[model samples]
Target: MVARRNWAGNVHYAARRFHEPTSVDELRRLVAGSDRLRAAGTGHSFNRFGDTTGDLVSLAGLPPDVTLDRDRSTVTVPAALRYGDLATALHAQGHALANLASLPHISVAGAVATGTHGSGVRNGNLASAVAALELVTADGDLLTLDRDADGDMFAGAVVSLGALGVVTRVTLDVAPAFTLCQYVRLGLAREALDEALDSAYSVSIFTDWRTPLLREVWVKQHAELPPPPAGWLGTTAAETPRHPVAGLSPEHCTPQLGPPGPWHERLPHFRLGFIPSSGDELQSEYHVPRAAGADALAALDEVAHLIAPVLQVCELRAVAADRLWLSPNHGRDSLAIHFTWVGDAAAVTPVVAAVEERLAPFSPRPHWGKVFGLAPAAVAAAWPRYADFLALMVRLDPSGTFRTDLLDRYFPRP
Candidate 1:
């Protein structure tokens, strides 16, 4: 919509019609006219979730309407609103989201549909925050999806992968905004991964995969009293083992706050405007069982030696269990190991293979946006709900207008 090209450079087949629709009727008209149609949000998804060669319908111009009911403690928002915008608005009303993914720039609707998450022991995927939704089905029918209305559709739409329909609005159960004491410290020797994780509201580790050591650990505590009003934030109650060595590569940095109370900025340590990343950087993340996190990290270490030197970064984090069928957590608490590299995937593809080979014992769920992947059959091993998810997709979008090569790869024709 904005100059045609998106942030990720997802190109269309041709210079097609770009429509910005505010109402469902306008979107329906746009979709009806085009042979192949797809709705796009802020275009934050890294892959082709919004990649349609036909008409591209953007909901950017849609007015943002958020109303909060303190008595019920829920806030309803326009699906097109970015989480960053949503968070700020929510904070103004003394409300906050339960959790937020690393980057706040993504649209809540887009992120929820893809199962976006943040590191936390008590939090679930963003979609799990939904209490209700205003959905526009392909046949131009409007429906409000809720847990009681249609259970399967409700579960599937959470990670619907933008398949079921265009989510126009979302109402979420919110919590009273609380301050977090962000503690960050090097964990050169902290091996208390699971136990330490259990103590904090959220945690993050920035480490080089090549080493057996946890380079650093970041813990966020529930602060009844504001954190030390000076100096850098400290790591949580997790014990950090002593570093026997002087220094590895001397590359360690801490997470910083953009501003307090606004949870969206806190989701990501670095903002696109504050600090720019490599123009050619690529990201791939996988979710493993929380119980298997330690073992998976050990297996990853075996290949870490191969990737350490060439790799940009390896991030370790956790996400709470959720009921959303396609959420990475699915029925189990999840630990995500993420990778960001500087160039073509080929340089890191072999390392990813080594990880997959070693991680066979603990089937890993790959993130939808990033590229490291397995076929549909492989995904079935990671998420048991594949069959149910596929079945719902067929019923909701039998014609496959929302289908793409990526969807087909993860979801073979039934």
Candidate 2:
């Protein structure tokens, strides 16, 4: 119980008073009694950001109550609903989320709070799909937020990272459901990221320092026909991003049609799914200005000497720019660079140092879910309105009822 794996494979001190509350009433009581508490969902995060010293809250068992608003084209789901089930439920109602992550196993609340995103040039992160949310704040006070009202909370809640409150339910903007004609291709050199960048709506390449040559690229085109009738869906790994370590880098993985089906298939690389080529690997993802992609790639490569061997894979993804304060792609169209490692995290962390060291001019936004040893000042430096957000948090949770050591890490100094 002390040691558990998050989706990104980071471990830390877990909660002593872990609970799955069935109702707000039970949660209020639990929250009121705890000295230190944190809510966890699927343990899919990369760092101990969810780790707590005294108590942990697991929302997996909560009853899922889903509601659809046909007029507004929105779906409201309990915070605990797995993204997989949420999508399926939404589909049955003749609706689908605006876009979904590659792997749909994550929780809607957790993903949005952390600004989880899938590759897309025009689309936005999952948090953008949120139209409204019900949050239980520090004093166990329930509050509602949306674009039309409580705008400040709405801005903070979109990517709150659990700092503002415990999200209870989320109302997401939905679109007419559709299917994708998927193809995974290899060969987008770290250098060619610019040349081939605009070819697909969503593209992700997996590789590490060992091969500067991009290893795997997932390509998809919207299709009217519902997913190619079984066998025609391309079973063998012969297509793109050929599975089973192709180059000097040996990845322990087998390529199949795609696991976890439609939902989990969205994000095929992360855990609660396939582990990709490297076993027990560590990962780091930094989102930088899209213009700096080439430069960022060059910087990551500079650390190849220290990172080449332990590096299992690196992924490149593009995201449309947005105005969200804490968004990694804030104010600029962005490229997310990922580093997957084959060995020790303590050893591989230096790679992050090198990437950060070289990318100082770019001022990259670190993925909230990955392991990177940058101080809060550095983290907040990437987010301009972080100070305002802190002020807002103080106003809303002045008692610090929702506070944790992790929260202190970000707000304590200020």
Candidate 3:
């Protein structure tokens, strides 16, 4: 049998077999009968969180059903649906999601489960929009959890890390479709980041840490908002489109240079169909308190030499805090420091360790789906409600049929 690797081609899944269930009933049956099983969504995660020693199920073949409730301003979609496709459908129906990750190709369920987020001082992570979800549990019984009525338990369930069950459907809050414009500035000084950081709707600063000067600052704004001065932020506007990673063709990137377009199109750095970021890259992100942005940048700057050797690029963004228990942005507004490293794991691991150590003082939370060097104990300790999440997981799946080594490593049965 062929071994299946993840999107980043890093971890090879150890599943004995892979199955694509065409219907919810088929999915439930396959999962119910298996001693060990886990769901795979679009194969976008960089780690073994989705890997299992038993059956590996994909909901891709499931019907892509989308039901809209215009009165309640919500949309119910199959879990396997990719955000990119969902965004297109939502726009056509005159609705939209508040934010999207840097790449739109990820499955909605996977993105929400991993706490994936987009950049915005006011916007919460994608999971924050999940009003409700349905999952097929170990017994073949379908279970539904609502964010509003489920109370504290729902907060932990939203970011399940593939431990609770096979999520089959997700209901998300929607908003009136809107348009945005993207602007880019090149070679801005590090000091300028403080003054210009929260000045825009959604701001991202991209750099490689090779130099003290930042490489790019992407400013996304509402179409109706006035444009900043041409020489705004003391840097020249990019006359043409620019990719986040230097030397790559800007063709893969969305429209830039102040052109107004659908929010779904302009918000993500890469266009839906194009390869996102560098095709050969490993990602690791750490979120620190929003106010700790300067200290975090300085901490990373001290290790620039160690990082630049294996680094592809580093991205900086902010996310508003939410109530989701497992979300990195929980409790406090955060500044996310992301590293897109060259795909060499051996060379990148030490650098990731150094980064974690440097940011340790601030209690940074690592992105769950990406590569990281922190120990399982440290990760659990960082989340105050982690013990509660573990209890919830055990209560939901006592047999541990849906549990993976990844979850067990970080959250063991208490």
Candidate 4:
């Protein structure tokens, strides 16, 4: 069998066989027959979170049953549906999600399962939008969990990291469609991030960490709100469109320079039709308390020299607190420090360690789907509800049918 690698060509799945079932019945049979199984979606993860030694399944072949409930203000979508497609469909019907990650090509189930997020001081991670979800557990029995009905368990299940079972469908809360405008500021000073984060609906600051000045600040503001000042924070607006990573062509990026557009178009940094970021790159992100944003920056600045050689670009964004058990921004408002590293794992691994060490004082929580070298013990200590999530995992799949090597290492079964 030809080896299947992840989007970044980083993790090659070790599944003995790969299956793509076209219907729910077919998927159920596949899951029931396999002693161990794991489901993959869009292959966007940088690590082995989706890998298994047993059979592997992909839900992409399942029918995208997008159902919208106007009264309830929710949309139940197939797990395999991409965010970009979902956003377009919602906008046509005068609805929209609260926010979107930088890249819209990711599967909704995959993104939410791993606690993926977009930037905004008041916005929660993608998983927080899950009002309900359907998953086929180890016994091939379909189970549905609702945010209001399930209470604490639902919070734990939304960000399961593929441990409980294969999420088949998700019901997400929606809002009235809105418009926003994108603007890019060049050469922003490092200390001005807090002010800038609150200046727009969503903001992303990008830098290479070699200097005190940030490379670019991309702001998405509500069209109804007043526009940002022309020369705010000693920064000048970019005359033309710009990419997050310096020197890369801006053709793949979303429109900039303050033209009003639908929320779907402006919220994400990259256009859905194009590959996001440097396609050949490795990513790592950490969430620290928003209160420590400045101190976290200072900590990393001490190791800037170590990060510069292997770094492509780094991003800083804010995320509001949530109740999700495993979400990085679980208890406190957060500042997500993201790293896009050169594809070379050998060169990047040590740098990542140095970064984790630097941010240790802030009790940083690593992004579940990204590459990180944090020890299992350190990871467990970071999340207040880690043990609760483990209990939920066992309750849903006691046989460990969905467990992978990565899951076993971080959440070892008793």
Judging by lDDT against the true structure, name the best candidate.
4
**For each candidate, what TM-score against the reference?**
0.87, 0.86, 0.97, 0.98
Assess candidate 2 and give its TM-score to the true structure. 0.86
Give the least accurate 10-residue stretch of model 1, judged by summed lDDT.
242-251
RMSD of each: 4.8, 4.8, 1.4, 1.3
Q: Model 3, stretches more than 4 Å misplaced?
A: 1-3
| Candidate 2 lDDT tens digits, 1-414 | 222446555575555565778887777677666656677876667776677776677666666778888898888888878776787777676667766665567788888877888877777888878889887777777888887776755776678777777788899998887655555555445566664557554566666567656666665445443432333222223343344234642232222333323422343343334333323667678889888888777776677787677676666778887666677776788888877666487677776787778877788888787767777788888887788778877876676656776668866734
> What lDDT does each candidate get?
0.69, 0.68, 0.89, 0.92
Q: Cα deviation of 180 in candidate 3 (Å)? A: 0.6
**lDDT (0-100) at residue 203 of candidate 1?**
71
Residue runs of model 1 more than 4 Å from their true location after superposition: 3-15, 225-267, 271-279
Model 3 is weakest, by summed lDDT over 10 consecutive residues, at 1-10
lDDT by residue (tens digit), candidate 1, 1-414: 433655545333332677788777787666555566677776555566567666667787777677898997888888878776777788887888888776677787888888877788778878888888887776766779886677866877778878777788888889987766555555445466776567567777777765566766655666554542332232333233212112422112223431233354445443423323323556678899998888888777777777676567777788888878888888998898887765565676777677777777888888776656565567887777788888988887777767766677778669
lDDT score, candidate 4: 0.92
* Error at 53, model 4, angstroms: 0.9
Clash numbers, per candidate: 6, 11, 0, 0
How far out, in Å, is residue 154 in model 2?
A: 1.0
**lDDT score for residue 146 of model 1:** 82
Estimate the TM-score for candidate 4.
0.98
**What residue pairs clash in candidate 4, if any at all?**
none
Rank order (by lDDT, best first): 4, 3, 1, 2
Off by over 4 Å in 2: 1-9, 224-279
